[model samples]
Target: MTLVLVRKLLRDVRWGLFAVCLLLFVFSAFWVKIAQRVTTEIAPFFNGVAAVSKINPKLFDEVIFKGPGKVSQAVLGGAEIRFDRPDDFLSVELLHPVVVIVTALWAVSRSSGAVAGEIDRGTMELLLSQPIPRNRLILAHLIVDAVTIPALVLSIVAGTQLGLALIGPFEVDYSVLQKLDLPPMVRLPAGPPVLEVHAARQWYAVVNLAALVFALSGTTMLVSALGRNRWRAVAAAGLIVIGMFVANVIGQLWDSAAFVRPVTVFYYYQPQKIWLKENWTVDLGEAWAGGSPMVEIPVMPVLIGVGAIGYLLALRVFDRRDLPAPL
Candidate 1:
């Protein structure tokens, strides 16, 4: 029964899955170009700042500045490092929201007809006529849908990583050249240049993608179980996803309006704080010194939990529901 269920789902969605994987590869390649452009444009500004201050160029070139504060004379006297300019890690940070929206919409579109559409088309009755129990049948479908989420996400990650690796070195050198204060005549002895990629930020983006896919997939699955047809399920899921995005944008724009924050799923997804260079700071005095927005934002564990619970409830509803014959 489980094998049959898996086979049916694979047959139905394999082409769609292939299309999604291809799209992800394209986006991954796009990101590499974006990263290169940002590196080329921003690094020179920091280098110019360092040169004007007459600080050790190496320190400013490599070190990512977190914040601006007065350096104590004692610390300055003993320190070998002079000025630190924050790395403009905005490329990935800026791109995070786009990735979230795309992935959520994709998941919703895929899962919107998982169960209800089958029932509406009278295919559910044929499946149930087999030896498989209703509960087991619904469970099998849920499992198959759930597995696709991770597979899709990992494909995106792998493609992104491969693209980045290919272009990362050129970007790093371009950044260094843009930052160099010397005249065209004075060339520094070029050795093997060090490339520093923020692995943590990339991993965080992947985690965010996974969380969103999990949430949206669960939501659409529930809608599919409850909705009368594929069109209704898709509409409901699309409305929910779009509404969440709009609410989030409104909350961000009017952050002082405390009431709006709770309504936005965006409030919980703080990619800017986690990925941006300027927001990453350490304050010695407080337990949580850095004022990264992510720190203040409430985690959406409840949303995730509710989504999971909803899917289980949906399976139960689907198991008991009667399937009408097709016209």
Candidate 2:
């Protein structure tokens, strides 16, 4: 019976799922292409800058690295931007504002319709009249998430691989004569070096992204369970996601607001950090250690816990609340 409900729900959302998967796949490939262009174009310019800056130590180290570089770092989650590793460059795309918002919107759209949407459409009475238990209904929706979120993430993975294949491995171009204002025939001595993108390294961040989607969907499901209108539920969940995202960004840039990060789900959505880690393990003891979001709190587990709690609360509320009369 639950299987039937899950299948019906999947059929209803299949088109929406396909659209999202296509969008994610295209965006992922596009970002990879952008990274490749940066490698080919910007790499030489940066090389020229460093070479010329050798005449004035302050130009490279102080003016560029510490000045504008710091701002870029803060905005991109506070890690030094490493041009040498193209994988790091690719990972930056995953953390882009567009990617974050799209994934959150997917969650908001799906979860918001679970309960509140039915009630809003005067279909909750009809749905409940079926033998499907309320818990199973929610479970079926969760099952939908389990299927769809991976399709979205895997689309990104496939797109990235496709882009990487198109670009081939990184090769440094020392042909800096045209890009810089150096004396007529001067050529660059060295170019940036990079390793091919590894499947495992990318998976680390992919898992983090999945965990983020899970957290958002689960949290929004609670909101959906509480409201009667799907749009209101969407607005509420969307606001929460935007608020947390803003807080996370601000917290990165400001010391005073640093305290607010851990409480926001975005704090755990560190794709770059996870990509750079040498090892992965979960430690509950460090969940809130040092009152900073920098602590290693086992990203997947913490996020899953947040989602679990939200679902449990939604279940409890959903079971007890009475439905309004059909409009």
Candidate 3:
């Protein structure tokens, strides 16, 4: 059963999707570099002021702020750069939706053919004739889908890291490095440390990513099981994912309204707080001034847990349903 499942999954690992993810990683890397350069330039000025009592260059470098003024001033010189903030380590947080969209597409594509497509293509009868039980078959497909989620995520993280390493600034002050106890071998072209995380923020991002992935994969699987055709299943999943994104944007733009906040999965994913402030301690007040109130929400865990239970229910549904007539 495991071998069958592995074989089935390997067959569906589309090169096109991999290529798209690679492209996104490249773009995300460049964006990271731009943000780093802007922040580093302004970071020195604040460091210099703080160093009035002690003129150590490292002192300025070690100081972390919370807002985007310094980086923003360095880049645009008082002009607003839309969502771009001065304090952000990598502007990548602003582009997180791109990540979600790409991963969601990959998830939908993997599951779209799990059930309905097999029936439509006349392979369902052949599988049903085998020794495997229907529940086992459903479980196999679910396992394959779950494994693929992490595989794709790692790819994105690798691609983004490599991209940033190549194009971003490489040299940082040894004193700042010493203060942080970062290894001398570590380097970037023009940014802070590559793998930075605040204890609180890192935990937040992990929870957020896990929840988002589970929710997305489960929803896609359920749709695949419920739809009458592969195309329909994929379409349904895509719409739902896109709808979540749209709802999140609406909620942010109009914070007072309660309607959009409840529906959007994005309302729960707060990378700025998790990655920027909680992980790296990049000085949000000096670098980027606004507080993300979404971090205060208690509903994030509930939403994520609910989505997971929903996916388990989907697995049950897939196992019980009889295959449609062979095409």
**Model 2 lDDT, full chain set:** 0.78
Q: What value does the lDDT take at residue 253 in candidate 1?
A: 37
- Clashes in candidate 1: how many? 2
Clashes of each: 2, 0, 27
lDDT of 2 by residue, 1-327 (tens): 889989988998899889888888889888887887666656555656666555532344355547557656665655465654577788787787777878888999999999999899898898889988899888998899899989888988888888878878766555554555667566555644554666457777888898899899999999999999999999999999989988877776666776677788887777887777644443322233443334446677878888888888889889889889996
Give the TM-score of each candidate: 0.70, 0.88, 0.65
Can you give the lDDT of residue 162 in candidate 3?
67
lDDT per residue for candidate 3 within 1-327, as digits (tens), equals: 656866766666756556755766675666556555544444533443434334654433234211443332322211222222333545344335566667667767766777767766778788878888776766776566566555655555555466556754433332442344334664422334332322233334445555566677677777877766888888888998888776655433444543555556655555555555453222222212343333334435655665666567777887777667764
Pick the TM-score winner: 2
**What lDDT is reached at residue 162 by model 2?**
84
Candidate 1 local lDDT, 112-187, one digit each (tens): 7677777767787787778987777657666775777677767766776787667665333434554657767654
* Model 1 global lDDT (CA atoms, 0 to 1): 0.58
Off by over 4 Å in 1: 42-98, 170-195, 256-258, 271-300
lDDT minimum window of 10 residues, candidate 2: 282-291
Candidate 2 regions exceeding 4 Å error are 55-72, 178-187, 192-195, 279-295
